[model samples]
Target: MAERLHDPWLVAVWPGMGTVAMGAGYYLMAKLGMHLWEELPARDLFEVDHVDVKDGLIQTAPLPRSRLFLWKDPNEKHDLIVFIGEAQPPAKSAQICHQLIDLVRPLGVTRVFTFAAMATGLRPGEHGRVFGAAIDRGTLDRFRDLDLTVLEGGQINGLNGVLLGVAAESGMQGGCLLGEMPQLFSQLPYPKASLAVLEFFATLAGIKIDLTELESHAQDVEDKLETFLSRIEQAIHQVEGAGESAIPALDADEEDEKKKPKLSAEDRQHLEQLFTEAKADRARAYFLKQELDRLKVFRDFEDRFLDLFKK
Candidate 1:
């Protein structure tokens, strides 16, 4: 990547916990119509080349691309540059960070924002809070003024987390916006968390985005999740009620014959844990939905009230 972008504020979003942050970043790219400006060449970062075998032939699919995109917000003085990646660098991610900083420096990138998910064990259906961490006071103050929660002591692992520190080393202002989500959803693609992140980013970056698509997606997820949770709860109840009756008895002759092992106390304990986690996941989802509803109502009233002043 050359010094193609000049004086642009940059945001780097990588796949991470819940896939929330990456989804939000990609959503912004689509909504803002960002154009691919330069390439970082995934070849330099990822060690393994991913390939697919289709039918009888082996197809070497294109390597994962890590690229920079540009979106000139006509309304703003500074331009926006976004770095989107399909895969994180396998090794020496620190070197990758430095390379990114070098690429953006000539572009006059003084600030970098990264998106991430925070597993705070917060209950579901509750409003997923946005947390902020920054390298400089100015950027930290901006977060404070935005009323974003400041993240306390904790290490944010991975490229999405480390990029901020690297940018700060180069005298660039750096910050990360994190959305709260259940720990169990770490491996899940959490649209709700992504939506929360985007909501915060909209306010923090002063970018006006119509979140209708994300909102719809979030609603659909919640709908399906509600049904799933209900079924899980029912199953848990049945399992608990059945007790020992749920397990098939071993023949007494099994003392001398080989027999299948029955569900042990440990197995029951594990099942109980799963049931508990399922309930918690459902609760968190419910609270998040409630939070969205409140926001929707508020936005509706705000729009109508503003319309009253329109000519």
Candidate 2:
């Protein structure tokens, strides 16, 4: 026998800064806002107790090898699937998702969702627009009010594209909530966007996300990111400008400048410290670098993600 698996119909999340906000929000609600967010504290609404994460690739198709969590509604038997993993897409993440779906849905999982974000030119001051797309039109119509500027945004590359396609194939209900964080949000946390996504998810799940911790973290992440972007912008200006083709046109002359990262001891230590924060998601961290190495544009912005969770 397959040992009679558990936690089907779970609410899955991937490990990233977004997951941090989602998990933090869930934690705050379960711990302090229980009176308002859920009818049951531990088992019904937030099921962190059910998380199972592996060290390596858990899925190989279109999804990340997600660490799984099962959120159940106490008053009712209804549940949501949460997978927390460092996501890539349509390569390994899909496989992990399919495995999870096969294991859980037979038990009664009717819907699934994955939390992620997109790097955009939009800044936090711009209401942190939350974009959502569903596996089906019905789901799209459902989230029309959350303020998505790009109904076509989900068409972009990576896990966002594949997961939705898989959801459609599996005959399961699925949706993705993508928050617009400034392009600089990559390689660092972005709290404003994270909070916006959580609030949007809470509305869908019919629960309120406790935003106290998220608000605090958002302030910190925002400050650091603000500084980082200023530097990047300044660097851009000193060299040229932040235009599409203005990055000094990395030609032969620039090729020589592309050596190892030049850093002071303090900067090296800080980089190491950043890696430590992602200890649970080493694969993602490694792959991110590899992808960065392969990127043609600014050595690729895709891998510079500020992923902060086991996702």
CA deviation > 4 Å runs, candidate 2: 1-10, 15-66, 86-93, 146-150, 153-156, 227-311
Judge candidate 1 at residue 67 and give its lDDT: 76
lDDT of 1: 0.69
lDDT tens digits by residue: candidate 1, 1-311: 44354457888988788778776876676566566677787668766556767788888766566777787777765578888777786787898889889998886789998889998665445577888899899989988898889997788889877788898888888698888887744555567888988898777667787777788877666555545445556666778766555544322421221232445677547544543442444222223323323333312232222122111
Compare the candidates by TM-score and give the number of the best one.
Answer: 1
- lDDT by residue (tens digit), candidate 2, 63-96: 1223443344554434444443443332454665
Model 1, TM vs. native: 0.72
In order, the Cα lDDT scores of the candidates are 0.69, 0.50
- Residue 141: error of model 1 in Å? 1.9
Give the Cα error of residue 105 in candidate 1, in Å: 1.2
- After TM-score superposition, the amount by which residue 178's alpha carbon in candidate 2 deviates from its true location, in angstroms, is 0.5
TM-score of every candidate: 0.72, 0.55
